[model samples]
Target: MEVLINLTLNGLATGMLIFLLAAGLTLIFGLMDVLNFAHGGLFAWGAYSGTWIYTSTGSFFAGIAGAILTGLILGLATEKWIIKPVYGNHIQQILITLGLMLVLSEMLKVVWGPNQISASPPSYLAGSWELGNIIIIKYRVFIIAVGLMVFALVQYVLKSTKIGLVVRAGVMDKEMVQSLGINIQKIFMMVFMVGAAMAALGGVLLAPYSGVIYAEMGLEFAILAFIVVVIGGMGSFPGSILAAVLVGLSGSFMAYYVPSLSLAVNMLLMSAVLIFRPQGLFGLKG
Candidate 1:
């Protein structure tokens, strides 16, 4: 029973983190059809920047705010200079963004040096809670709460607002949206910024959870985010959340019961999904 609870908690926490990362990726891809290999760079930047701020100010909240701000600024710059020129060109987007990814990773070395940095949850979130023989980590709970809030906020905005309507419509038919006198370029830029911010949020939250962070961590998790995006459906925000949770739970159970299959499990799942539903579980068919 205790083991079950622990695994559940672990899976949910991990899922939330992945959801935070993949949510942005899927949205961007769905809307813009541009594959951004450099998205992970934003994540690494968040972790490093957030950690530095937390260390300097002795406040976790400030650290998160700083990280998000960094992501927003970088996102704007990336959209304008790097991504803009390559719009509507998948080949160029892939090549340039892949190069950008390497640059971002290498830049991290220049800025933070070659050492992995240690991170810890703030004092208030450092402990665990016990309830009838089950122990729950406070930081995990906090992460889960933040993830849900973010998801809800995104959902609400997408479902209840005019901007969201335009974004959703644009995903279906970019030409139609533009024909309707909408400046879709502005919407694209906004979505990119939000996605970048979410990726950064995932990075900052992951720092304390993992207990240490390094430059290449972004690439590592970016693979997982890609998987989640594929499995969740290209443009389905809710699908990303559900897929992330599934991936998280599968990993948790497999790691404990079949250690050798832990790494292969997610791949196997993705393959099955691809074979069975190429459009993804929640993706709309054209």
Candidate 2:
């Protein structure tokens, strides 16, 4: 039972990290209708930059803050320069984003060097707590806390704030929202920046969790993030959280009890959902 609980906690932590990444990916797709392959590039940049800050300052919190800022800046640049021109054209968007992805990725290697860097949890998060027969890792707990916080905050913003309402409305019908005297383009920039920050934050958090950061790691995880986004339903924040948790848990348990099937687990889950409901588990249909 204790082992089961430990695995569950681990899975939840992993899910939360993925949730951070997928949340931004979904929101970008949902509101902007831009398929951004460069999202992963932002993720890699976050890990590299955050790790550098953390190492230099010897402060994990500072690392996280710096990483988020890096994401915001990159997001702004990409939106203004690369993505702006490609809007409304799927082929152009795809080509440009893919190109941007390559450019950003190479820039990571140039700036950070082409080597994997190791990351460790902060001192306060380095140990484990024992509860009767169970052991809970502090970093995992911290991740879960942060993830839930992000979820709650986003939910509140979406349900209660004017900006949130606009985003939600835009998701449903962007043209209709634009017709109502709103600057949809400005909103797109804000949403894109926020999403980029989230992805960068995810990368920073994941760096220590995985113990090593590398340029190529972003693409590997991006694949999983994309799967989670598709499974959860495009444009549904709640759906992304739920689907991420499910994928995280499945991956965790499968790795322990069914190693060979671990890689196939997510694909199978996605396949099942697609076969039954092509729009995805929570995606709003067009």
Residues 2-117 of candidate 1 have per-residue lDDT tens digits of 99888988899999999998999889988999878999999999899999999899999999999999889888999999999989888999999989988998998899898999
Q: For each predicted model, how many residue pairs clash, with residues at least 3 apart or on different chains? A: 0, 0
Model 2 scores worst on lDDT over the 10 consecutive residues at 277-286
Root-mean-square deviation of candidate 1: 0.9
Global Cα RMSD, each model: 0.9, 0.9
lDDT of 2 by residue, 1-286 (tens): 9879988999999999999999999999999888788889899889899999999999999999999999999999999999998789999998999898888889998988898899999998999999887888999999999999999998999999999999999999999999999999999999999999999999999999999998998887788888898899888899999999999999999999999998799999998888898777999962
lDDT of 1 at 126: 96
Clashing pairs in 1: none
TM-scores, all candidates, are 0.98, 0.98
Candidate 1's C-alpha runs over 4 A off are none
